[model samples]
Target: MLAKIEELLEQAKLAIDSATSVEVLYEAKVKFLGKQGSFSHLLKEMGKLTPDDRKTIGKRANEVRDILEGKYAVRENLLKDQELNSQLEAQKIDVTLPGVAPERGVLHPLWRVTKEMCEIFSRLGFSVRTGPHIEKDFYNFDALNIPPDHASRDLQDTFYINDGVDRKPGDFSPWLLRTHTSPVQIRSMLTEKPPLRIVSPGGVYRSDSDMSHAPHFHQVEGLLIDQDVSMADLKGTLGFFAREFFGSEVEVRLRPSYFPFVEPGAELDASCPFCKSKGCGMCKGSGWIELGGCGMVHPLVFKQVEMEYPKWNGFAFGMGVDRMAVVKYGVSHIGLLTENDLRFLGQFRP
Candidate 1:
């Protein structure tokens, strides 16, 4: 029985050494040490031997089992270390690779041009002022010297929220999206006493859309109210703006035009920056670009705001911010400004 136990220990040692994994090593342990195993079978046969011989065989079997268990524990730890090293090698990352850069965002072209225009005016003692997009009929039209019967007040031109109907007389002014930033001028005048120098810039809505126009657009309106303001001051102010904005050499000209709120309203034009006023496709061979409208504030406009006309007269001018952006950046379409396509907007990045 002792000889048989020595042989079993040798076989268990060989099995444990050849095991590639902990699972295989465990099966080898069970083969020798388990109830139906060689070692257990040999112990059961010890009853046939003398009592002294049985005691000697049991002691030898216990020593063999302890030796085999130690061998298995050492082999199991070695296999586990190898497995962990292989897993870590598979997951290792290279530290020297260049990192991916994140994308950056920029302002829309319309807003860029709006800021530029406001900054130019801001440098000239004109403080910025803003008003609500939703406006009352009195401030938008009546206070701006635009009569109810005016063509601009028609449903075809303006967008009305309440349509000024079905209300008790003098209940409240009907609401509508403002047609121009001129309403902001009226708002500022009604609230504050002048000498006021302000430039109003904001979104305006109208029932209009085309290659050059949009249903929703932006405008910057300028107002200067004080004693003895004149058309010359308006022209000089606009002229300086044209030279500074377009180029140092660009010239300005105002063609005689009519508007409801100005005594001598004129269409403001600047020499084409592209052609240097030498005639081109951009200016349609005229060498001039129509910018916007400017004129002296009308007497009735002052009356509506309850300011004395000749005593507190001023000049007001308005220009389309979208149009300015189109002209400055040479954008093909006004509608491109409204479309949120990153491809189109990416070109205007500063």
Candidate 2:
């Protein structure tokens, strides 16, 4: 038995050393150390030996098993390392090749205009503010002094969201896609204190569409509140914005208008930058492009917001970003801004 054990161990060492791969090493291990192999067979035959012979065979068997295990482990580790190196060599990457160029993307025209407007207002001491695109009825309309039955709330004009449960026509927090960014002003007023100067820019929704109007569009609304704010302050701020944005030579005017949220709302128009205030087809020969609306914050709005009326007088304005982009760049069709045409947007890059 002792002789047989030594012979098997020698065979195992030679097999393990000659193995060139992990699979070959694994086969050698199974043949020598497996349950049905010669080593295990030797253990089963131990009962036939005399005590003295049994002790001698056992000692030799242990010595042979230890040598076989050490050789198997060493060869297994070497073969595994060689296999890993071979795989890595086959998968090596060449860093000298010319890189593939990724298609470049630029900001959308509407976003570009919105960013430019916000940046201009930011330089004028206004911080940007935003609210949920899904707003409550109170903030979007009620808080802005629009009553429930107001023309703006008609289904043909507003985008009201239906609650999953039975609900009233106008619950306390009835959800709807905000019609304008003015609701953000109400939200800011509710949480923030007076002396607020903020510009809200985000996507708005209405039930309208045309060459100049889309069901979805972007707007940037400005709000400024202080102790001594007036219509003149409104004019100066918007006038500066118009000159900086359109051109230093462009003129701005505020004609009498009506908005439920503004005490004396006025339509804001800028002298055509394209025609330089001269008759042009772009401006429909009027020499003026309608910009947006602006006015003193209505007293009812302050009352709804719980801000002391007359004590905190401020002005608010909202401009359509689509229209601004058209006016700024002389876009003939509003739909071009949203058509995902890279050519139209590429013109506005930087």
Q: Compare the candidates by TM-score and give the number of the best one.
A: 1
Candidate 2 ranges with C-alpha deviation above 4 Å: 1-101, 167-173
lDDT of 1 by residue, 1-350 (tens): 67778888889899999999878878987888778877888888888999899788888878898998899889999989988999999999988989887877899998998888989998889999999999988888888888777888887788888664687743433688999999889989999999999999999999987766688999988999999999899999999888878889888899889999998899999999999989987788999999999999999899888997787889999999988888898877778889899999988767
Clashing pairs in 1: none
- TM-scores across all candidates? 0.83, 0.70
Write down the lDDT that model 1 would get. 0.88
Top candidate by lDDT: 2
Write model 2 residue lDDT over 202-252, tens digit each, in one string. 999998876657999999999999998988899999999999998899888
CA shift of 140, model 1, Å: 0.7
For every candidate structure, what is the RMSD over all alpha carbons to the true structure, in angstroms? Answer: 3.7, 8.8
Worst 10 residues of 1 by lDDT: 164-173
